[model samples]
Target chain A: MAYSPAVQELMEALRCLPGVGPKSAQRMTFSLLQHDRSAAGRLARALQTAADSVGECRLCRNLTEADLCPLCASGRRDPGLLCVVENPSDVQALEDATDYGGLYFVLKGRLSPLDGIGPGELGLESLEARLAAGEVGEIILAVSPTVEGEATAQYIAGMAADAGVDIARIAHGVPLGGDLDYVDAGTLSHAFAGRARYR
Target chain B: MAYSPAVQELMEALRCLPGVGPKSAQRMTFSLLQHDRSAAGRLARALQTAADSVGECRLCRNLTEADLCPLCASGRRDPGLLCVVENPSDVQALEDATDYGGLYFVLKGRLSPLDGIGPGELGLESLEARLAAGEVGEIILAVSPTVEGEATAQYIAGMAADAGVDIARIAHGVPLGGDLDYVDAGTLSHAFAGRARYR
Candidate 1:
C-alpha cells in the first residue's frame, strides 16, 4: 500500500497473468522498474503488437498473426494426418515433445454443455467441413481424458465416420518411466485396460 | 518453434521477467492471446507508463512516478527514524509484515566492488547529507545479512557516527516460531548471542 499510483497499477495489471498472484506481481513490478526498464519497454511493445495483430489462423484456428499458421502453411508437414488439440498450448506441448509431423486443428475448448461450451465453441463446424473435404486421411484426437473430452472425442469420431475417414485417440495410459506402485488407480486401470501385446 | 513471429516475439520478450522460463513464457503468451487480450493491453499500457514515468524518489531514492515516494511524502510517518533497506521490494515486504512507521532510504544495492557498485550507486552521499541535517534521531539498518549487506551497514554506521546521529541495526536471529532443531547453526548462534533477558 506504500507503493505509488503507477507502481500499484502495474502490480494490479500483472495479476491478469494466469499464475501471477499479488506477491509475484509486486516482485515482477519491482524487478522491471528497478532492474530492466528496457526489457519492460520491449515487453510492452511486444504485448501491444501481439494483442493488436494476432488472430485465429484461418485453416487450423490456431493463434497466428497471419491467415494460416506455420504448420498449416508450411506444406512440408503431413496434411492428411491432422491432430486435434484442446488449446494452443497443447499444440506447442505436442510439437515440442513429439516428431509427429502433422498439421493441427485447435479446438479452443472441450464440449461442456452444462457450462454452455458445445461443439460450436470447439469449432466443430469448421472441423466437420474440413473432414468432408476428403483431404484428411486420419483424424488424431489429442484431447485430455476428462469427461467432456471423452464426449468431444466421440462426437468428432462420429464426424470422421460420417466422412468415411479413420479416427484415433491418443493413448491414455501410464507414462513410460513411471513406477507402477506410485501410479494412481485411474491411470493404472487405464494402462491395464489398454495394454498392448509385448513385441 | 511452431510459434508465429508475433507470438514468438512476445514469448521472447516475456523471458525478461525474473523467474519466467521458456515454458512459462509460452504459457503466458497463450493465456494472454487466447483468454485475455484486454488484460494484455492493460498490462502493456501499465508497463509502458511505469517504465517511462517512474523514477527514483528524491528524499529516500525509492521508486515513484512523482517527485517523492508515498512513504517519503506522507507527513504522518516518523521522519526522525529512517530505515535503510536494499530495494523497493524490501520496503514492501517490511510494510506488509511490520508496523514500522518510519520513512526509508532505499540502497538499491549494497557494497560490491566486483560488481562495480559502491557508496555512490546506493546514494550514501544523500544519506550523509540527510543525517547531517540534524533532524533524524535514529538510523535503522534493515539491509540483508549477506557479506555486502554487512559492509554496507558498517559503512552507513560510520556515516551516522560522523554526523553524530545514533544508529541501530534490526536484530538478526532465528525467525519467530522457527524450530530450533531445523534452524541453521549460523542463525542459532546469532539468536543465542543476541538473546534478551525475559522480564
Candidate 2:
C-alpha cells in the first residue's frame, strides 16, 4: 500500500518550503494529482529557473537575474542612503510600505553567535568596502528589534562609527494602533527611551 | 522604484503555487537569492519531469509514470476485486491504509449535473467494458456519501446490474468516533437508512 517511489519523492521535495509539513505535503501532492498539472509544472520550472538564473546584486545584495539588482541599477534611487536588513524578504516588506527610496544591503542572515553565524558570514567585508567608497552619506539600520537583530544592528553601528558614516536605526517602540496596556515590557521600555519631545 | 523586469517576472511566476500570494512570492524569490542556487534548479527540474512523465494509468485511470500504475502492475494484489474511487489521491490514501489487496479504478470525477459533470465525462462506458471482460467479480463502490457521490454510485450500480456483476456499495452510518447528538440531519437520515439488524 505504499505510494510509488516517484510520488513519495515529489512529496518529500515539496515539504522543503516554509510552513509546509507532512499533512500539507500530502494535500499538495494529492492536489497535483487531481488538478492543475500546469501549475505543478510551473513550480518545477520556477525552482530550476530561479536557481540557475537568479543571483545577488553585487552592489545592493538583493536578488537579481543580472549582475546588479534593479534597486541598485535604477539611477533614480538614492545610493547615498543605504538601508541594511537581515534578509532579502525584509526589502520586499519595506517596499510594500512605500516609504523608502534608497538602496539596500541584505545580510542574507543574522549574527547568531550561538549558531556560529558571525559578521563575516553575513557579508560584512562587502559592507566595509561599500562604506569606504565614501559615496554613502547615511545608513539606516532596518534590522528587526529582536535580540539577534539588535546585536547585529549594534555591531553594524560600531562599524559605521569607525567608518565616519551617519548611522540611524529604524524606530523600535509602540505600534501606531497598539494599546499602551497591551504593549510588551521591552517595547514599553524602548518607547520610554525613544520618547519624542512635545512642543 | 519598479523592480527589474527579470525580478518582477520571476516573482509573479513564483506566486502560481497554492497559498502563495504576491508577498510570499516575493519572499520566496528573494530567499532563492541567498540559499543554494541548486535547490531552485532542482525544483524547476522536478516540475517539468513530473508534468511530462506522470500521466493516467491505462487500466485504473489513476496517475502513473508508466502505462500501468504501480498498483496495477504489482503481482501481489488481487485483480478480481476492483475498488472504484473518485480520484487518484483516494487510491493513495487507500494504499496507505495497507489493508486492501484489491485492484482499483479511478473515476477522475463524480456525477455533478450542476457543474456539468456527468457519467460520460467519468468514463462510465470504459467501466462497463471492464466489467464485461468478466475478470472482475465483486465491484466495491467506495465513493463518499454526499448527494453527488450517492447519485454516482446509484448510476454505476444500475450499469453493474445490467452487466450481471455483483455490486456492493460501502456501508454508510455514523462515523466510528462521531457523537449522535452532533450528527447532521443528512447523516442521521442516512444512518437510519443504512442501519444493520440489531441482535
Candidate 3:
C-alpha cells in the first residue's frame, strides 16, 4: 500500500539529500513522524530560513547571508593573499586545519565540460575583477588533485599570470601517516620529483 | 569561525535526525544550500505539513492522516487475522514480502522496562479492546527477536489466551541465503530446536 500523501511528499523531499536513497528516505520519514515532532518542526523552519536567506558572498562566492562573507569582510585577513577552492566546504576545511590568515574565493564547482561548467559558469569574470583591483599579490590554488581540478587550477593560474599575481598550487604528496608502500605509483613519482632537501 | 546564523540553525536542526551527527549535519546543510535550494524548500514544507497533519490511526495505532490506517480501513484485508508488530516499518516489511491478507496493529515500541516502556505505553489497552470485539480469530506476534520483544510477545500471547483467541509468534531461525557458519550460535540453537519433520 502507498503512504499517505503527506508522508509520501516528505519521503520524496528527503530524497533530495546528497546520499539519501529511497529506502533511507522512507526510514527517515517514518523516524521523523514517529518521534521528535518538535525537532521536525525546527528542521522545517531551519530549511525554510536557510533556503530563503542564504546566498553567495558577492566578493568571494562563498555561502553567506551578506554581501561579503565573514572571511572576506574580516579586517584580520591578509587581502594580498587569496586562496581559490572548488566549494564552500573546502573553505571550512582549510579554516579548520590551517592558521592561514588569508581571504578565499569559492568557485562553487570545478571545470566539467561534459556537465557544461566552464570559466563563465564559475563567475570567473568577477574573480578577474577582484584580482584586477591589485590588492591580491599571491593567488593560491587549493582545488582538489583530480584531473578536472588540475585543469581548473591551470586555467586559473593563466588568469593569475595575466593579472600579474604570483600563483601557487597547493602541494600534493603521500598524506601524512600514509605508508609509502601503499601510495599509488603516480603520486609516489610526483612526491619524489617535488621532494624537499634535508636541512 | 562560526557559521552564519541561518546555516548554523539548519545544521543544528539536521542533527536532530537519528544517526546524523554534527559532521553529517554540517555537510547536509552545506549541500542543501549549495546544490538544491528548491529541494530544501520542498523538504521544509513537507516536514511542516507531515508534522502538522499526520497522526496515529484510531483503530491500530499506525501512522495515518485519517482516523483509521489504510490497512484497517480496507475491505480486502481479513479482519479475523491480526498481526501485532513493534513498529510501523515492520508492517511495511511484512506487506512487502508476505501475501498475508491480514490487518496489523502497530505497538510503536516494545516492552523495555529499563526505558520505562510498559503495556500502557504500548497502547495494549486498545489492542485488548480490539480482541474483545471478537472479530479477530488469530493473532500473529511479529515483534523482533530481542529480549524486550520476547517479553512483549509472551505478554500478548497471555492476553490472547485470556481472550480465547489463537496466538502464534513468527518463527525465528537462520535468515534466508545466510551461510550456516556465519549464523550466530543462539540462532543456530533456535533453528535446531525448532526443526520440523520432513514431508
Highest TM-score: give the candidate number.
Answer: 1
Ranking by lDDT: 1, 3, 2
* lDDT string, candidate 1, A40-99, tens digits: 999999999999999999989999999998889898998899999999989888988999
Off by over 4 Å in 2: B1-7, B30-33
- Candidate 1 ranges beyond 4 A from true positions: none
All candidates: DockQ: 0.81, 0.50, 0.71
The candidate, 2 or 3, that scores higher on DockQ is: 3
What is candidate 3's lDDT per residue for A1-199, written digit by digit as tens? 8366788789899988877888888888888999888889999999999999999888888888877788888888999999999988788889999998999999989999999999998889998998899999999999998999998998999889999999998899999999999999989999999999999
Against the unseen true structure, what C-alpha lDDT does each candidate score? 0.93, 0.80, 0.89
Q: After superposition, how far is residue B146 of candidate 1 from its true place, in Å?
A: 2.2
lDDT score for residue A82 of model 2: 90
Question: B1-199, model 3: which lDDT tens digit per residue?
Answer: 7366788789889988777887888889888998789999999999999999999889888888888877888889999999999888888889999999989988999999899999999999989988999999999999999999999999999899999999998899999999999999999999999998999
Scored by lDDT, model 1 comes in at: 0.93
- Distance from true location, Cα of A101 in model 3, Å: 0.6
Candidate 3 regions with alpha-carbon error over 4 angstroms:
none
In angstroms, give how far residue A168 of model 1 lies from its true place: 1.6
Full-model lDDT, candidate 3: 0.89
Lowest-sum lDDT 10-residue window in model 1 chain A? A17-26
